[model samples]
Target: MNSIPWSISPSTRGWRYAIAVSTVVLVGLFLAQGADLVSEDNEMLLYLGTLVFAALYLGRGPTRAATVTSLFILNVGHIHPGFRIGFHKFQYVISFGIFLVLSEQIARLADNVRREAWQSEELYLFTQECARLTSPQKVLELLCQHARRYCGLELFASLAQIKGAPLQTPRGIYGWVTPAVQGNLLLDSLQAQTALALERIVQSERSRQASVLEATQKLQSTLINSISHDLQTPISSIRGSVDTLKTCELPDQDRQVLLDLASDQIARLQKLVQNILNLSKIEAGGLILCLRWISVEEMVAGVVEGFPAPARARIRWQVAEEIPEVQADFSLLSQLLSNLLDNALKFSQGPVAVEVSAGLNSVRLSVSDQGFGVAPTEREKIFERFYRGQTPRHVPGTGLGLNICLGIAELHHATLRVEALEPGSRFVLEMPRKQEVTHV
Candidate 1:
């Protein structure tokens, strides 16, 4: 009902009026050319063509223009008495004018539809962001606002991950809640799923935090219990044996054996301490390798030389003759090799074999044992900190050997994988072929 300002405002009535006027003009011309066949007194009937056109397209002004032109021509041609703008003409003119007015009103309806569509797009994007955005509270508020705009009705706004559930808003509960409390109505079949999904994201984060904390606490407890027992008995025996040797004059050969046993125990304790420190460094994300080009010969020889004779006798070799040098930290690389050999020997019933191979862009060193092999499913998860092979149950280990080996491998930008063998598991360390960077 509001007045439409005189502009090219969008109106279907305007479109209809323009169409109507064109129809009338074309029809009126046909009637004029066929004047002989048409009635002189009923000449105004020719303008009906213009009326129909005006009714469909043109507004009142244009329709009136067509009417005036039709009237003027009729008067000048002596086809009728001087101009007669009669009551009937006034009625037709007014009817067309009213039609123009109604078109403007219909335009407002069109505008409302356009506005609704625009708002819908905005709300859709907002809803999507609400689903994907970080911070569950912000997502909750966004969903609630969008739901209000979408259905023009809202019941509740909230996010549920572990604990807190905000309630009593406009949009009804879309199943994020436990549904125990009132106000979050469980509506049938709707698409506010993202809100519920947001809660799940929070739950996942909480679950991860809980698991990490538990693993850390477990590692700490295991280390304490293990260190106390592993170090205590060996140290006490070594001290008692040394004290006895100091008092009693024994044969040189017997004294050397006792000394060797004590030394081995001391070395074992030192290795455990070193492993603990290395594991701590890795957990803190501080593991770094002082990388250098070390020949494969050097790496293998170094690891073998450090091994006690009994262990070394059990190891066999299948290394390639022309083994290329690898970029690695010498100490860490040796430890990585040593850990693999130790794991192999510990698990193997008999001989352990080491093999080195090369591919297009990488080199692989594998240590295989004939012990009880690993299952395929456990291979990927074995690298996680303190994850032991076959769960060590009664065996004495901190379970940090493989994890420390992993950290060392990672520092060298290498990958470690466990391959299941028929008799045992083969551990492979693969690294990209290090290319020399020459200065320009």
Candidate 2:
């Protein structure tokens, strides 16, 4: 109640009093014109209309003013003695007193209603504002601002890590709000609500942190397990070959074969590491393309020749006679082709067809292999990092190949997609032709 000032603005009070006086005077004159039909004793009864109006809108002061002015006007203008309170006017006095008491009670009730309405509106707006805020600090700041504006109280609200009660007032201050009686209750309720909201936000943040920690732990376990299994075979092969070379007097051809085997294993290790690094860079948003116009035929031929003899023998091509050059990063395009061809050869014994065709604005290079095509549900999932399918259990892979290829294609502004053929899976790379074609 202390937070709510009892007085209205002088200008507003003056306006309400003016309206009350004008209404009373007009109604009194109207009654005077009908004097013949009404008795002098009943004239005060008409003023009740003006008094009720004043009570509802004009508050106690203006309503009392209206009541006093109406009684004076009745005693002076309509009484038999005319402006004198004689013996016959005692009944009029009694009526005036009853009207005054009734008006005061009605005004008091209206004032209570008005104050409750104002408080309800302020609390509702505060709740809406709090709902829009995400941070606890912001909610506290808004709470303090509303306290100062609505309650006329300067509050100091802060989140503390103390034990004991939820709200503390160790300073022995009356309350956080002014006029310590009702204000204390209001402040207590508000503080408890704010504390509960803050606690809920804190609990939510803790849950989110726990979820992130659990995900990180799971990823760490998965990477360690996957890399360990993938890397162990090649590493053990290389170690065994090196040990044999060091301990045994093997034939020259056998030693050469072991050396080649070690070299191949080392190359495989390097490729695996490169794929992992590429994926990390892509995830970190650091993959940048060094694009240049390049001959599609030569790039595909070079990539095909880099494969092992048996793998190279499985590749066949039908490139267009005069395919236009595409703007792309050379090393990334090579890796993309390498991953596709490796995937095809790993899964099927049938020859892999490397087809390059020219369109009006783009060139398409597709590698199709006659293997069990990707499952309908697993088509898109296969392109996710470290995702492996159920088929080809005997094949060795880190499952980063297709994902890395997809990232490189995106960096080069190309599109990569997979389609299920009748007896094969076709992996297509469509690069926009940004340069003119030249006959070789």
Candidate 3:
């Protein structure tokens, strides 16, 4: 059932058949000369074997030539009254006819087996390729390519109905081909494989959409819960302070204390609201950068001065000498550093150190705090929105600070990361020394 081992041109095939037949005939003649060796019947069998070889290896034209040559040589050289075409008896004529019939039948059977094997091989390869493709359009394109290569047919898809026997699947009619290719078995098999590949692609897309939907729902729920808890606490504190001032008479000093407490709670509420608004603007792709050249020392000083005197006294900062200026959105960069400093002050009792240093191609700003350092496993998770690690419940935070800082760093094409220190943790932001600012 295997095909001919190799393909040959028509001229080359003729030469091979001639050489093979000549060899067989010469060997037959030698044996025939020895009267005791090959009888006339045995000589006929030798030529018959030559016909079988031609059919299996040399193809239809060669096989037919071999059959006719065998018949002619047997009649003239091996039959009675040798070296003449006349038959000695009617039985000899019938024997020659039967030999011709058997040779033709063998050739026909071999051709059928070879054709079926070839079809099976083509189908197997086509199915294997389709199984690996995830795009339905790609599968369809491959189907057209295969049709053109193997069947000499030009195939194309159309949404409208067309005449002739189009290749139709359950989805709809795929395309039509020339009359010669309408019922080709290989084409039909390719169409079926394409249909299955398209179905698989659709199923995969549906599964991906379902996964994204589930994740979005979970994110929405977490945001709502975090916002509600963070909002209620500051509002309640501000309300209680006001009610006490209005309802009870108090010394001026005590009233002033209550007023400061109310102001502090109001500031906390404003910060929380601002963080939420910034996060919304970032996620909605509305945060625009106003880039300008600014000195690192001045930027650090400005952010430190914005904090309360008590908090600022606990902060120690240094700028490496000769550090060049960087182009960045001043306010956004200031907000990023402020968040890091605030977190440091809230958690650490000892002084927080801010160091600004420059590298060959980048500028590095790091804030280190002497507080409970972030655990190795929780370092990355700490940057996720609304994610708070094992901080005690009494610490008031919305967990949006680090996430917003990350967003700001990304907008300016910078890298932000955390390093655990011996007594606390260090948050580092590295920015390219020179950058082209483009609207995000």
Candidate that would win on TM-score: 3
Displacement of residue 427 (Cα, Å) in model 3 is 1.9
lDDT of 2 by residue, 278-376 (tens): 888887887777768888898999999877677889999889888988887778788899899989998888999999999999999999999878988
lDDT of 1 by residue, 152-233 (tens): 4463544433333433223443334332233432221123445455655566788999999998798789778867877887
- Angstrom error of the Cα, residue 5, model 2: value is 16
| lDDT winner | 3
What TM-score does candidate 3 reach?
A: 0.77
Per-residue lDDT of model 3, residues 1-440, tens digit only:
22323423334775867865775677556756775777778777878888888777666666777788788777776674357888769998899899989888887777567666767787788888888897666776887788877666788743234554455567655454333354678787877777666666776898999998998898788888877887788788888889999999999999988887777778667777778888999888898888899998999999998776678899999999999999898888998998999899988899999999999989999999999899999999999988889887777677889999999999889999999999999999999976676544
- Ranked by TM-score, the better of candidates 1 and 2 is 2
Q: After aligning candidate 2 to the native by TM-score, how far in Å is the CA of 161 from where it should be?
A: 9.4
**Residue pairs clashing, model 2:** none
Which residue pairs collide, candidate 3? none
TM-score of each: 0.60, 0.74, 0.77
**Model 2 lDDT, full chain set:** 0.77
RMSD of 2: 6.5
